[model samples]
Each structure stands twice: as C-alpha cells, then as structure tokens.
Target: MGRGAGAEGSWPKTARAALSGAGGRGDGGGWDVTVGGFWCTARPSGAPPLPERGWQLRVSAAPAAGEAVLSAVVRVLAADPCGFRFAAGQECLSVLDSGTDEPGSTGAFITVHPADDAQFQRLAAELDRATAGLPGPVLPADRPYRAGSRVHYRYGAFAPPAEPGDDGEHRPVPRRPGGERGEDARGRSYRTPGRGRLPFGASGAEAVTAAGATAGATAGPGTAAGSGAAAAAARRRRGGALPAGRYAVTAVVRQCAQGGVFLGREASGGAEVVVKQARAHPAAGRAGADARDALRHEAALLARLAGQGVAPRAVELIEQEDSVFLVQERIAGQPLDGWVAARLRRDDGPGVDWAEAGPVAHGLLDLVERVHAQRLVLRGLSPGNVMVRPDGTLRLVGLGLAVETGRPAGPAGTPGYRAPEHGPGRLAPARSRVADPAVDLYALGGLLFLLATGHDPLLPEDLPRARPVPERLGRWLALAARTGGTARRLAPVVLGLRAEQPRQRWGTARVRAALREDSPGRTDATRPGGNPGTASRSDAAGPSAVPPRPRLGGPRRRPAPAPPAVRRSPSDTTGVSGA
Candidate 1:
C-alpha cells in the first residue's frame, strides 16, 4: 500500500502517496493495501449545495474471507464542513483546544453499509478519480503483513490503523501539541507494554481520530462526520435560510483587521454555525490576525466558561482542515459604546454640552471597576470590547484576552484593550513573562477615559488637558491616564499591593478610598436608574472556584469536573449570592 503522510515535513507528497494508483491495489488474500480510492472533499458549512449523490467511490479488488477483520478507516485529512452529518454506527469525538500550532483533530469510521451499493460505488469512483496517482500519507515505520489476517500498519503520523473486527478509528498524532503522546520511531500507535491494558477477554481497544471529523466532537451511538467548509457553502446556495435551531458545523467564527466580523450561518433555521478559523497554525493567514485569534481564544474560553460572562457563549467548536472555528451564540444587543451614550448627541454646537454622556461615562467607569474586582485583567480593555444590550444594559465582553490571576494564562487579552503591561501596537506573547495586576488598573483608567471621551487615552490627541479636572472625576480619570513616573507613584495604590516600583506599583483598597468619594451613581447600574429596575448583571460564568462538595457523597469525587464547574444560581456567580 502507498503511504499517506510523512513526518520529515512534506505536503502533497504524503497526500499523493495515499491516493497513488486511485483504484485496484489490495487483494486481501493479497498485495499490500494499495492506494485504491481516496475521496476527500470538504464542505465548511455554508456556501454550496452538495450533489444529491455527488459523493461516489470506485475502488476495486475484493478482500479475502477472514479479511473481514481487515477494514479501511476513512479519515478526514482536512475538512471545513459548515453543517455535516455522518451515518449511524460512527463515533464523533470532540477535540477541544486546537493549540497554536496543532489545531484540533477528530473523526469517525466509514460506516458504509453493504446495502448502499450506489453511494459506495460513487464514493469509490470519486476517490479513484481524485486521489489517483497521489502519494499516500507516508508511514515512516513501514511494515509488511500477510492478508486474511488484520495487519496493523504504522505510518507517518498514523496510529491504531483500524478496528480489529468492525475496525476502529483512531486519531493521528500531530507534529507537536501543547502536550505530547507516546510514539515510536515512526508515527504509529503502540501501547506501553503493560500499562492500562484491558484484561485478555476484554481487550481495551484503542482508537484516536484525525482532526475535524465528527459532529460536536462527540463519540456515541449515532455519530456523524461533518463536511468541510467548501461543500457546506455549496449546500447553502441550493437551500434557503435555514430554519431556526442549533446546528453542528465545521466552520469557525472570524474577526477581521478592519474589525469586520463574519461567521457562516446555515441559510435555513439553524442550518449551520460557521466561524472562520486561523488558517496556518500559530497564526491566521488572513486579515485581523490579532482579532481573529482573539475571537478564537475568546470563543474557547466562553465555551469553557459557558453561562458565565467570561466571553460570548459559543455553540460548537469546529476544527477544520486548516483553521480553528467556534460557533458562538448570536446575541442581540448593541456595542457598549452605543448604550453608554444613548442620550442624544447634539454635534451641532461644539461647546453646548456632552453632559448627556455623563451617566453613560459613569456607568462605563463603574463597570470597569466591577471588571477589575472580578480579579481579571482584560488585556483588550478598549471600547470595542464592551457591548450594550438593546435593553440598555452594558456587558463587558471579549475576555479572550483577559488575564485571570488564577488560571494558567493563555494569550487572553488584546494589546490596546490589554493592561498597561502590554504595548500599544503589539500584543504580549504568552511566554514573554508573567503578567501582574497593576497593569490592569492602569488599563482600566484608559478604558474609563474612552468611555468618557470617544478616543483612546494612549493617543496624544486624546490626552487630558493640562488644566485640572473636577476634584471627583479628575482624580479618578487622572489615575487612569497616569503614565511613566506618575503611573509608578499611584499604580501600587491602585493595584492594592504594597510594592512601590514601576513594575510593582500596586493598588490597595484603602488607597482607593483616600482618592475621592465614589462618583455619583457609582453603585447604581450603568443605565438610567429612574425605572427602579436596575438591570441585573447576567448570571454569566465567573472566576473559577473550587467549593467543598456537598458531603452527601462519601469521599470527594475523583477527577475534578473542570473550571466554570460550579452550578450558577439566579445570580451571575455560583453558590454565593451576588451583593
């Protein structure tokens, strides 16, 4: 059989190897499993209409009797299906966290039943035509085995070849990952001689997946393989707007440099949820590189922190052949900037008054304080990060770039919206250095300034005038805009830490009190308060917490559930009543 992929870095070479000699290769009682037919078409959620029977197969040669054990596991080398569906008797495994370089991998089996003669034949024909003469994925640790009996072939990156009887499907090991898995000279699956081995009669079968293979990444009774982005788009052209409902997709949410956001949604009601993923790992190959990845990070965090205001709630995580996608819950609301200045703006006369923006600015400031108190440093602390719901409620979003003092920080915050530690034009690398909290207070001030003045504090034109501001607002805004030497002096107090150096400028709570009395309506909601119905902060997810389990259970539960783990009550937080 020809190889499919290789390790020493090569592209079409591997793919071609697997598809070399499109049809007619293995004869079970047989020659090696030649590259018979390789049909790999991706449909990433919403662009075209898949032919009613566009999918086809044309592989020849029959396997021997006992060759029943010898099964071919169809894997998704790469896909971008927006709304994919797989047949029954398949396993869909969700691969979360598609890391910087190594995106997520997932897949199931080619449960092509014998009765499906037409579809199978079509699939075979298509595979032969497309993959003909293409090289196979190089199997570094090559092995030769006899027919009739199942032969486990190890290849470049491919492991756990196929299921023993029904033939199992397994994930291929990536070049590198946030973590590592056991491997041999070549990329093949091998169990530690005696570790976790299933008992003799009950052998623990091992199965992994190729990236982006299943619906919702779930493995169960009725599993399906999602198509790639291209195919899904074709389907959309054929069908109209989808009816309304959640859809399992293979597309990703994308943010552009121009700040334009585009997501692929199934035309009908909830047909498919599409998000544009960063093409090349480690970074995106498109515009809005920063915002794009930030959106991804934010989506993943929100997925992990579902229900919490950590980030917008995502519907599904779709790992396509080339990018990482997140299907997020579509929220209906305005950006916070719009709500803050809900009052009419009379741009006609310049000096008249922008006072209507008062409560808006104040509300924004109050929210900023709440954000900091949450013990998170939103690296992307700019106006664009905030959202204003149609109901006149303000929500701080885009936590994708936030720095949670508690968790192992990933690339969470954005540059401008980031804390003072981050530079203005460039974002800080995840490994650059450990970040501190004071920088957040500094950025909070900047964020507040933006709420007050539509421009950024860092911009020279947006700087406060040399003249003194009111004792109340001036003191607060001053601390927010303090830079260099001035920032060093007040930062420590603002951070509530005892340090006094530029790096260690902390702000203790006592010092905050000494600055000035609370600004008017500071405690009240950010919106108008006359209605008496202060919009309650959403019961969004909160900082991760570990509470003592209700002891009705004997010993503590094995293996903690995971963060955003608590049951959220009516309030935004879990267990504790919101003050």
Candidate 2:
C-alpha cells in the first residue's frame, strides 16, 4: 500500500511521512494516511488549528439517501441530552451541499461543530462502538471528494484494505452492465452507499428523487403516507397528488398526523418553505376525503390567524389534483420543552420562583388570550407546540388541531396538558361539544408551572426535589397553596386557572391581574394609587400599565441571558399529529 501514483508534488514532510506509515502516532501533530479501498488522509495540523471552542464533525451520505440521512442525523443531534449531549444552535451544524444538484455527484455533506470537543469525542466513540461489527463493501478511490475534506471518513473510504483471497489473487473489481464501468445495470451511476461522492457525470437530485420514490413505494403500512396502494390510487386520480409547478419538494421531513410534511424550496426565490400536505391514508371513500377536508379546515384557520404571531404565517395555499398543500414560512426558534430544559441547565440561580415565572407566564397567557379573542381555540397547546425565539419571546405553533370555539371535535391535544373535561373519559355519551377558553387556561397554568419548577404540575410524582431559592418565594408558594396572605398570591392564581372544572377556573383578566400583582417592584394593583386594574385586563388596551417584568428576578442592569436553543424531535418539523 502506498500513495497514489498521481501524488507527484511538494507534499509536506509530515504528510509524506504519514503516507508512508513511518513512525506516526495517533496523537502526533501530522497527517496520517490509510491506503487501499479509498484513501484516507488525516492532516490534523495541515490547516491552522481551530479554536478549542467547538469540535467539528463531518458527515457524508450517499446521494441516494443524502437528504434523509442528513435530516436523521440532525434530529439525532438535536435530541435531548441523554447518553451523549450536543448543543442545539444554528451554528451547531450545517449542510454543506446535497450532491443532488451537482452533476455526477452522489452524496450529501454536512459539518457538525459541537460546542464541546470532549462531548463530541464521547459521541463519536459511542457511535463507533454501536456499529462495531457491521460488514461493508470497499469504496473506490476515484470518488470525487477525498478524505482530505471536512467530510473525512464519513464514507467507506476509511475502511482497511482487504487481504489476498485464498486463490492468491485480489477480488476482481465489480463492473457495470454491458461490461462498461462506473454505472449499474439500471444505467444509474454506481457507488456504494456513503462512499465519498458521486460519479463523474451523475445527477444528485435525480438520484435522491429516485431513492425517495423507491422508499415511498416500499414504505410500511403504519407510516404517515406513501405506499404501493396509495401511490397507485394517487396515479389513478392524477400523475401525483400535489399540484404541478410552483414549489419544488426538497425532502420529506416526516409524516405528521396522517399526512406527510415536505421541505420545499420556492422556485421563484429559492427560499426554504414548509409544505404540509393532507394525510394520505390508504382507506378509500369518504373517510380519506374527510381527513383531507380536516387539513383544509386547519389551513383555512391558519390563514385567518396569520400575522397574529401565535402561529407560523401561511405563505400560500395549493389545492389541485385532489391534494391540499399548506405552505408556511418555517418558524425559527426552539421548542418550549427544549428551551426550558436548556435554561434550567444554564441557570446557576434557583429555579424560576414566583417572580421569575411572572413575565413568561403572562406572555403565554396573553398569547393564548389573543387567540381566543380571535375566536379560535388552540386544541393542541403543549410544550412541544410552543417555540421560544432568540429574543426570549414565546411563539405558539402547532395549530393543526385548532378549531372555532364551540365546535365539536375529537380529542387532539397532548394528554398531560389537556383539561380534565376534554380527556377521552369526558368525551363519553354525556358532555358539551363546546370548546372552552378555560382549556387553554389550564394548559397555560401547566406551562407556567413547568417554567417555574421545571416539572409538569400534573405529573407530581416525578418532580425534581425542591432546591433553595434566593427569596423565600418557595415558602410563599407553599403558603399560597393553603391560604392567601400578601406573600402567598401566585399559587392561588395559578391553581385557580388550572382547576379541574372549567367553571372554577380564572378568566384571562384575573390571570393577568394576578401576574401583575406578583411581579416584584410593583405595588399591588388592589392597593391605593396602584395602576388601575382595568388596563391589565385587556391586551387590546393602549400600552400596558404594568411595568415590564423581569425574568428570573427583579430588574437588573445586564442584558438578560438569551433564551436557550430548542431541541426539536423528529416529529416536531411537521407537528405530525396535526399535519
């Protein structure tokens, strides 16, 4: 094994030594080259040393599965920190390129920069252990991309050379049909999955689309959409379910509800957009049409709620070929659960006490109130649906299950946060079909408790043990739970809002008034000379009479910490249940 015959240049002394396997250690500050299969060159010191701030991880996937692979990897990385943790941020990782657009290219490239090198190392080592015994084919040396690139070792190019066969001859190189080279029997470019890059003249997008089609054809019965029967039915109805032209589907994000969510790039502007299509259940007849109609109703509701900041703005609506596509601008923020977890991890101070929960609680309450005022009920409010923007403001999303007030609908909300009256048990023969504002209020209280205590109020058994806070707010909270004095105020309001029966729950006005009262440095609104309570009662009123409340504590001079990044689950992209 030696360097390629074409390696005739002023190679760096260290690199040359490494290629020859001359006394180079793993930790040595020089390049290391592995021969055979596909060449792997490591030049740890060839480029300027990156700062210790973040560790870079390069990922390369075969063109056929590139987009899916990259998406799966991002989901894995963005998941909550369990065995190995990776930070969630816009800078954490990037998709360098999907070989689909390039000629002869058959791979996707991505670079992951973990905020902590040690964590990256642990993750890499764990992955290495997990895939220990998987057998794989050798990669070809002529692949377009080389090991020297950031996507090093992502392909099978890093595999060790094969030993001589028993016949004392190396295995013969596989050939394409017609005895031609660099292509398969199907006339498609030939390359092992995750092998460096595409051939000299392959269309990456075509390969990926073909792969997606193949996958759709073979998708199992339980997935959100796409199967032999569905595709055949779709073909019978039209060439494809979606309308032709306008938006180009880039990748299938995931199946949501009974539908599929696709990532799309607008043809005119090349801007990224999300296309949420109606569910394509295999069941024929009115049931399927009903499902499609439900999605349309959702889209119409979303269009009406656009610009309210409670949901992502609907960009356009396309209804053709018996399919409905709701295109919306992608929301740029972290999930509420992820954000809260990140905040809890970063905060050195005590958990969100009464004062700290004031602003956040009020923000959510006001947002929900706004939606109710618009005559809509967010039937699916949950930590998963809320997104925390970088500016620390919260945006409510996942409006797929939203309905007009008083509308009778199936159970559609996250279970833990659902009001007792809306659960399956209460949906029996005897019940009102009307949706209640108090339902949203119940969810709001649950969210506030989560932010304050980092635990779901309903699931009290698993609550984190109480830690001391700077103020005696914990004691005040406990006292408020029993009897209300001056200090014991927030608990009563929160409890009242979350009461099991909707009739006993506090209204939006009372919740806001309580929040204003609990906020530190503000005189009690019920006291003399305090700002009139009427101002805080209605969000539509001019400027809020209550001063801006500080999070975590009373006002401080320093800018508040930026909200933590949200870790998104695979289903998050589509709000699968609603899509």
Candidate 3:
C-alpha cells in the first residue's frame, strides 16, 4: 500500500498482450477473420513476418457430465501482423476474474464443425508434429507469462522434442506452487513471456522445461501438410473432448429463472460431464451462444493456461449447434453474493457469521492485493463476480474484462457504490473505456458495505439488482460512499476521488488513499427509509453526467457522445502484438 511498489511503466513497444487489455488492438487496420475455433498469424506478401501479432489455436469438445481441458496453442507470427476477431457471446456471462478482463481477447474456445472434424484431425496432426520439436514456453504453475507467449505443441511448427533429454522425459517445467506473478492469474495484460523475474525464482529455457511448460505434450501424426480449404476444414472440425489435466469441468450446468441452477451430468460415467441446450430464451443464441461455443472458449482458456484457474477445459460444446453450452470446472460453493446472503439470512449481529466468514473475505481481498500488486486491475468487482465454498477458500472467477492498465476509465460502478465516473468516459477519458484498480476498489468497497450492512446498497431504482444496505449497517455504508456520488460527509475522501472533475482522481496513489479508507471509529446511520428524500446520488456537484459507454454492438450509423477528457493515455497498450 506504499511507495515500495514498482512504478507503472509505459506500454509494450509491440502489439504484445501486456496488461493494457484485449479490445481495439493497436492500429488493427480494419481487417478481420471470420468463424473461429482457431486463429492463425500471417505476414503480408513478401514480408519479414509479423513481429508481435500472435495467432491462437485450441481444441475443445463439451462432455456428457463434466468438461475436459485440452491442448491449446498461442503462435506469434513474424509475418504480416493481422488481427483475428470474435465475440464471447451476446450477453455477459460470469468471468472468473471479475472486472479485469482483456477487452478484445476472446477466451479460449474450440468449435469443430461436424463436417470439418476430419480435416481438423489431420491439421491437428500437422501442428502437433511442428510443435513437437519446438521449445516450450517458460512458465510455471504459479509463474505468470505475457499474454502471447507461445506454448509449444509436439506437432507441425509447434512440435516438441527435436532432441530428447538424456532422461527421455520432455524437460520438466518448473512449478511455482502458490506463488503468483504478472497481475495475479487473469488480471494483467502480460506480454513478457513467463521468463523474467519469477516469484518462485526459475527463469529462461530452464524455467520452461523445469515447469513442464511443454514437456510430454505431443500432437498426432499423418496431418495435412497444406491445402487451404482442407486446412481450414481441419481447423474448424478440431472440436473434440477436452483432455484430462489439472482442471475438470461440470457437465454444462443449467440455471433457469424458474428452477434455479440444475447440474446436468452424464447418464453413465460420473467422471463425464454434460451440457443441456437453452430453452429458446431470447438471450440465448441459436448459432450464437451455442453450448459448443461456451465450452469451446472455456476449454480454450483452460488449455492455453494449462488449467491455471477455475474454468475447466472444453470437452464438447454444441449438441444442436443452435444452443449455447457452457462447460466449466463446476467450482464448489455458492456465488459470493449467495454466500453473503445466506449469512445475512441468519441475522445474527456481527458475531459467528462474521467470524466464520472472515476467511472468505480475506481470500477475496488477498487475491485483489496480489492482482493489483501485479498492476492488474479487475475493474468490475462485485459479490456476483466472486465465489465462496464451504471450506471458505475463494477463487475470483471471470476474466473477460480484466486489464493491466487503467484508462479511459472512470466509475461505471455497480449500483450502491456506482461512482459518478463508471459511465462512458467519466474518468481519464483519452484512453480506453474500462476500469482499473481504483474502480475495482470502489466496487469491492460497495460489496463490503453490503456485507457489513446486510442490505443491497443499490435499490431496485438505483441498480440492476436488489442490493440495498440494511438500516443497521448505515455507518459502514457511509464510509464506502467515498466515491463522491454515494458518500455521506464524514467520509469526504471518497468524495474527493469520486469528485465530478476527472482531474481530482489524480494518480493511482491518490486514488488508492481515498478508496482504502477506514471508518471513523464508528458513526451515525444515514441509511434511507421510504421517502428519506435524499437527492439522487447522480446529482454530483462536480461535472454533470458524461455519456454512457459506446453501444456494445449497435450499428455504427450514429456516433455516441464521448465523455469529458481529464486526459491520460487511452490504454496505450492496444494489441502492440509480439510474435
């Protein structure tokens, strides 16, 4: 929490996957790749090869009862730096990392078209061959790596074991156990390969082999050397069951508004997982959010990370191809919100529940600290984004929006603590329209306020959910309101950070001081009742309202209003890709 921390550095020189984020990558030049279960990198005609732009390859298949994590690869091209794009799904699903998701980087996904499955097999074979001899990436279980660091496969260009080790073992990769580096798990845009300064100490090629980053993994034989259409077919049909590894997944778990979440398992093997089709809900996509796609992305991410987090690898995603299927590790425990809700239901005043719940809170905060120390920011932090199990161990799920640097960010916060800045471009407006550590804290504080107060801070009218703090918890709630729009006068610091003028937000140090504030040894309850007649929190006396975030995917016909510019680097680290 002090000056010992590393200074925030400049953006990566190339389009590397540094902590910046995933959307609107560096001067992408408007080129796009359609229909992906795989992404490939290529250079323009007669070029030296893309220096930073990277290509991705993953193989996934959903399951009957649970999903599997399979082998995936990230290939950086030295050829023309082209961009490949796709969407995770229409709606926002739960991301393990909460708010710190990389914007344009799609989660790992594998969707093999039935007709093309055959071709994918051969292509998979070739890739396996290529990667089999290549050096594996240098990353340990706990050691973090840059976003695009290549993980060698034993096929095609990514093959392994060009020279067998004297012991005949694919070199053993170093494992960091519980140590975390480079923005805690899923938060930062790590562009440096997992080679440098290790929290566990291993480094370089030794780190790669020491950690088993690419040892033992092999691709199949008899593959398509190359024939464009045939190659594409093979790539599309590579969707297969996820391979067993450090991670496991639930059969696609189904959550219905009517019946709650029902775990669907395979009828035969307990180890097998399954996914059920959506019941034609407007939100569910036909070809869009299909199960295969969901499982594909989940599996892809797991394989790419080698089962680093809670999301499981994909086994098989689509049955009907029209429905969306999601396969994941089937994490034990309830949603953090649900966990808190049950505790609150007991209604015992700050006694056993708090004592019992301490670990969960600590674990969540611990993760936040580690992530932020790595300079990773999960802008979107909410009870809904956290999970707590019976054992009290917590894993922050969701990484779709995590980013390394904070930019064009403001408050776009959840209800109660929804600061004035969260809307479109409220904070330093020049860069990306995303959240950072301060924003993450604002949300975390809001969640904490709810826990302490036993009321959802955001009333039905104030937010999307039913989280208003209980009257008894008013004093703590007031402290969390430091984000200007929501705080009471006693905790004026929160207001300073949340001040209408973006300039008032200042540096990360300034933001942190205001957000990490303490209660004044206790105070009066300002909790509102019916007709409490408080002015709407939105009536911030600083800057009026800024425009909302750009429409996620509306037609480009009309331009939206941009927010006021306090001015900072718009996440300068767009896809400064690194091959």
TM-score of each: 0.36, 0.47, 0.34
What is the TM-score ranking, best to worst? 2, 1, 3
Q: Which candidate is the best by lDDT?
A: 2
Best by TM-score: 2
- Candidate 2 residue spans exceeding 4 A from truth: 1-243, 281-289, 320-322, 346-358, 427-431, 460-490, 518-579
Tens digit per residue, CA lDDT, model 2, 1-579: 123533322222323442334222323434333322212233322434323222234443322333343334433333312111111111111111111122221122333433343545554444333323221111111121221121322222111233468889874333323444232111112223433233223355443334333233222111122347654553333333233456656666554223456776777898777777653221112122333576677678878877777777778877643346678777656676665665554334323444445556767887898899898888778888787666667677657677788777555567657876677666433343566566777777667656654545543222366432211223323422332222233444545455555655667876676666635323333233644223322221111121223243545555443222233233233322223
Which structure is stronger by lDDT: 1 or 3?
Answer: 3
lDDT of 3: 0.32
TM-score of 1: 0.36
**lDDT of model number 1:** 0.31
Candidate 1 lDDT by residue in tens digits, 1-579? 111322112212333343243333321111121121221222222334432221111111111110111112222212101212221110011110111111111111121211133433343333334333321211111111111111112212222222234345454433323344433332121122233222112232221112111211211101112246533443343231111223433322222111112334454465333333332212221221332365566665565555544345566655433234445544445554343344223342211122433344345545645655665555455555555555445556545556565454433343333443344445655532554454454555444444433333332222455422112223333332222222222222222221112233223332343233333222111113322121222111111111112232345445322111111112111100100
Predicted candidate 3 versus true structure: per-residue lDDT over 1-579, tens digit per residue: 111213211111112332123233323422222222122222222323221111123321121100111122213221212222211221211120111123212122221211122433444444344334222211111111221222211111111223347788563222233432112222111122433342224465434443232111211111121236543343334332222221222321222210012233443455433232221111112223332343344344444443333333344533321233433334555656566555543334421244554455446556666556655566656565566655667655544345556543333435555543565444545433554455654555445444444444443332456332332123333423322222222133222223333433323343333334354212111122212121323221211111112232466565333212111112211111000
Cα misplacement distance, residue 420 of candidate 1 (Å): 4.5
lDDT of 2: 0.45
Give the higher-lDDT candidate: 1 or 2: 2
Show model 3 residue runs off by greater than 4 Å: 1-269, 272-326, 345-347, 350-353, 373-376, 403-414, 417-419, 424-428, 431-435, 459-579
Off by over 4 Å in 1: 1-233, 236-297, 320-322, 337-375, 406-420, 424-432, 461-579
